[model samples]
Target: MDVTKKKVLNGYHVIFLVQNVMIGMSLLSLNNSLSAVGYSQWWFPILFGIIANITLIPMVWLSLQYKDDDLFDIHEKLLGKWIGKFLNTFLIIYAVVLFSAIIQHYLDLIQISVLPERKITGHLILFILLTVFIVKGGIKSLARFCILTFFLMGWIVYFLRWGIMYGEVSHLLPLFNFSSSEFWEAFRNGYNSMIGYEFLMFFFPYIIHPQKAFKHASIGIWITILFYLSVTIVGAMYFSEWQLENLFFPILKLFQAVDLTFVERIDTFGITIWVFLILTTAGAYLWMAKKGIDSVREKNSNYHIYAVAIFTYIIINLPFTQVMKETLYEKDFYVSYGLILWPTVLCIVHLVRWKKKEVV
Candidate 1:
C-alpha cells in the first residue's frame, strides 16, 4: 500500500466530513431516542444539539491554539510530556473503540433492518472491503467520496418531502409537557446522540488550508443540524407523539411508507443512503486514527503502520451476537463522554499552565 501524502480538506469538504460523522446511527436512532421522551420533545435534541455545539466550540478552538502541532503536541504542551503521552495513548484506544462500535452498529443495522435473511458475515466483509477502499483513497479521496454521496442527498430531500406531504399538522398540536425529570432525561438522552465534535482534535491538522478552517467547520455544523432537524421533524410529524412512542428507526420506517409507482420498494433506497452515510462516518474516524498513527512517524513513510492500524480495526469489527454489538455502543458512549469533557478541560488547563495573559 503506497501511503501518499494528501492535502488538507477544502471548505466544502469540511461540510461533507461533519455531516457524515454525525449522521450515521444517530439518524437511525433519533426517532427511537426522541421517542424515549415522547415525540412532544423530539425537538429537544435539536435545541440540545445547538447548545452542545456552542460549548464544544471552545474545545475545538483550543485545538487550533496548536494548529501547527497536531493534538498530541497540544496535549503534551499543556499537561507536560508524560501526561500528553498518556492522553495520546488514551486517544488511540478511544478511536479504535469508536471505529469498532460503528462497524458493529452499521453491520447489525443492515442485517436486521434491510437484509434480514442474508448471511450476517456478508455485512462484515463489506465493512472491511469498504473500510480498506476509503482508507486507501486517503483523505483526498474521502472528500471525493463525500462529493459522490451528494447524489444521495436528493433522495434525502425527497424522503423528507414525501413524508411531510403525508404528515398532518394536527398530529403535532397539543404540546404536552413532561415532568421535570422526564424533560431532563429526554434532553440528556438526545444529547447522547449528538456525537463527533471532538474529532477536530485529530482532523483539525489536516484541514489543509488553516485560514478557512473555522469558516468551513461552522458551515459543517450548521448543515449537519439542518439535515438532522429535517429528520427529527419528519419523525415527529408523520408519527404522532403517541405513534412513534417505542418504534426504533422511525426515520427508516418513514421512508418505508413512501410508495412510488415504479419505485415500489423504498427500503432499498433508504439502505443505500444509510450505506453512504456509514462510509463517511467510518472514513472520518479511520482518518483520525490513521492521522494519529502518522503523527508518530516522520510525516509520510511506509504504509505498513497505517495498514496495521486499520487492519486491527477491521478485526475488531467481527462479532457473532447482537448483544455484543449493542454492548460496544454502550461502551463507546461512556468512553466518548470522557473525550468530550476532557478536551475542553485540557484546553483550560493548558491556558492556565502557560499562564498567558492574552491569546498568543
Candidate 2:
C-alpha cells in the first residue's frame, strides 16, 4: 500500500493516538515503577512529559524533512540501502518484541486478577484475533479505535476522586526528599509509561497535517500526563510509602477505593475495561511491525500482518524461564530508550548530507 497516498488522519486522530498509546499497561504499575522517589513521584509524570516533548522535537523535525516517508523509508533514503535495511531489521525486531511483551504482560494480569481459574491460551487466541482484526484496517482504522478507546477509558480516571477524597493530604508533602540517584532510577523505571509516543515516528507519514503534528502530539502527551498525575497524586495520598513501593498494581487498589453499592469489585471492572487500552496499544505496535516488514520486502501484504502475529505468538510461547521472560519484557528497556534518542542521530545525518549537497 502507498502510505503517502493514505494520509487520512487529522489532528484529532493524532491527539488521541498519542494519548491512548501512552496510557496503556504501564499505568497500572506506574506508582511502583516510580517508588524509587517515594511519595514525590506524584510530580514525576510532568517531568516525563517534558522529556517526551523535548525528544519529540527531533522526531517531528526529521519527519518533516521527509513528508512522504516513514522512519523506515527515511532510514533507507538518508543512510544507504544496505545500512538502512540493516537498521530496519533491528527496528522490526524491536517492534515485534514490544508487541509480544505487551500482550504477554496483559495476559498475565488477566489470568491473575480477572480469570484466575481459566488457562491463558483461550484468552491469548481471542486477544490476538481482535488485535489482528483492528490492524487489518490500517492506520486510519487504528486511529479511530484509539479515539474510541480514549473516550471509553478516559472517564475511568474520574473514579480516582474516591481515592482522593479519602486519602491523607499529608502524604503529598516532603517533596524532593529522594536522592539524585534515586530520582534517576525512578525516571528510568517510570519512562516505560512514556514509550508509546515514539511510535509517532513510524506513523508520521499518515498524519494529514504533518506540519501541526508536533502541537497535536504535545497536546496528547500533556493530556496523558494530567491523567497520570492524578493517579500518582491519588496513589501518594491513599497508599503509605511502603504500600506504594510494594503494590504490584496500585491502580487496582485505587479502584478498590470506590465503594459503590451496585458494584462489588470495581477493580475487576476497571481491569476488564483496560483491555481496550491494551488492544489499541498492541494494535498500533503490530501495525508498526507490519510496516517494517513492508519496508523490508518492498511490498505491502496482509500476510505480513499475520506473519508478525505468528512470530509474536511464537516468541511469547517460547520455553524461556520465568526470569528470562521477565527480563525480556520488563527489565530490557534500553532498546526503547535508544529508539527515542535515535532521531537526533538522524537529524545530524540530514544536516551533513544537506551540507555536502550544497558544497557540490
Candidate 3:
C-alpha cells in the first residue's frame, strides 16, 4: 500500500477514534474501582483526563519529530534496530493481550447474562471474525466506524437521568472530603479506564492535520471524561458506599432503574448496544497490533491482522480458570501504564541527542 494514500484519518476521525476506544468495557466497573474515595470519586475522571492530556504531550511531541513514522519507527530511531525491535515485539504482544482481555470481558458478560448454555468459544470466534473484518478495511474504516459507534450508543447518557433522580443528592454534596491516600487509591484503581488514549502515538502519523491533532484528541479525552463523570456521579449518588464497592457492573444497575413501558430488559438492551463500543475498542487495538507486525516486517499487509485475530481467539478460549483470566486482565493495566509513560523517556533522549549534536 502507498504510505501517503494510507494516511486517511482527519481531525474528526482522530477525535472520535480516541473517544470510542477510551469508552470500553472498563466503564462498567469504573465506579467500583473508585469506590475507595466515596462520593468525591466523581472528580477522578476530570483528574484522569487532565493527566491523560499531559502525558499525551510527549507522545505528540515525539510523533511530530518524525511526521511520517509511527511509534515503532520512532523507537527504532531512538534505540537502534536490535533493542527497538525487541521492545516493539513486547508492545505487539501487549496490544494482542489488551485485545483479548476486552473480548474476554465482553464474552464473559454474554455468557452470564445472554447465553448461559452456549459455548464461549462460539461467541469468541464470531467476535474475532467481526473484528478482523473491520480491521481489513484499514484504520480509516475503523475511524469512520467509530463515528457511527459514537452515535449508535451515545444515547446511553439519557438513561442516567433515572439513576440521578432516584439517587440521594446529599451523597454528592461532600465533593473533596476524601483524604489524599484515599484519593490516590481511587485514582490507581480507576486509571485503567483512561488507558486507550496512549494509542495516540501509533495513530498520530495517520492524522491528516498533525498539528491540530492534539486539540481534536483533547476534545475526545474531555468528552469521554464527561461521560465517565456523569456515570460516576450517578453511581455514587444512587448506590450506597457498600453497593458501589460490591456491585461489579454499576452501569447495569443504573439501566435497571429505568422503568420503560415497552421494555423490561433495558439493561440487556444497553449491553447489546455496548457491543459497538467493544468492537471499536478491540478493533483499534487489534489494528495497532497488526501495525506492530508490519513495523517489524517493514511492510504493510492485512494477513497479520487475521493471524493476530486467530491468536487472540485461542488465548481467549484457553482452558484457564476465571481467576486466571481476571488476573491476566488486571495485569494489562501495568503494561498500559508503562506504555503510556515510555514516550516521555524517548522524548527526553531525543532532545539530549539533538542538543549534543548542536554543541558538537
Task: List lDDT for all candidates, in order.
Answer: 0.67, 0.91, 0.88
Candidate 1 on 173-194: residue-level lDDT in tens?
A: 4556567777776666666666
Write one digit per residue (lDDT tens) for candidate 3, span 1-360: 224435788899999999999988978889998998887787789889989999988888888898888898888898999898998999999899999999989988988887887887877888899888888888888998999999988888999999988999888878898889988888888998998898888888888899987899999999999999999988888999988888889889789989989999988998887999999999989999998898898888878888898899788878999899889878876889999899899989999989999999
> Higher lDDT: candidate 2 or 3?
2
| Predicted structure 1: lDDT | 0.67
Q: How close is candidate 1 to the true structure, as a TM-score?
A: 0.87
Question: What's the TM-score of each model vs. the native?
Answer: 0.87, 0.98, 0.97
Q: TM-score of model 2 relative to the true fold?
A: 0.98
For candidate 1, the clash count comes to 1
What is candidate 2's local distance difference test score? 0.91
2 or 3: which has the higher TM-score? 2
Kindly give the stretch of ten consecutive residues in candidate 1 with the minimal lDDT sum. Answer: 296-305
Rank the models by lDDT, top first: 2, 3, 1
Candidate 3 total steric clashes:
0
Q: Candidate 2, which segments miss by more than 4 Å at Cα? A: 1-4
Which regions of candidate 1 are displaced past 4 Å?
Answer: 1-7, 174-176, 296-321, 356-360
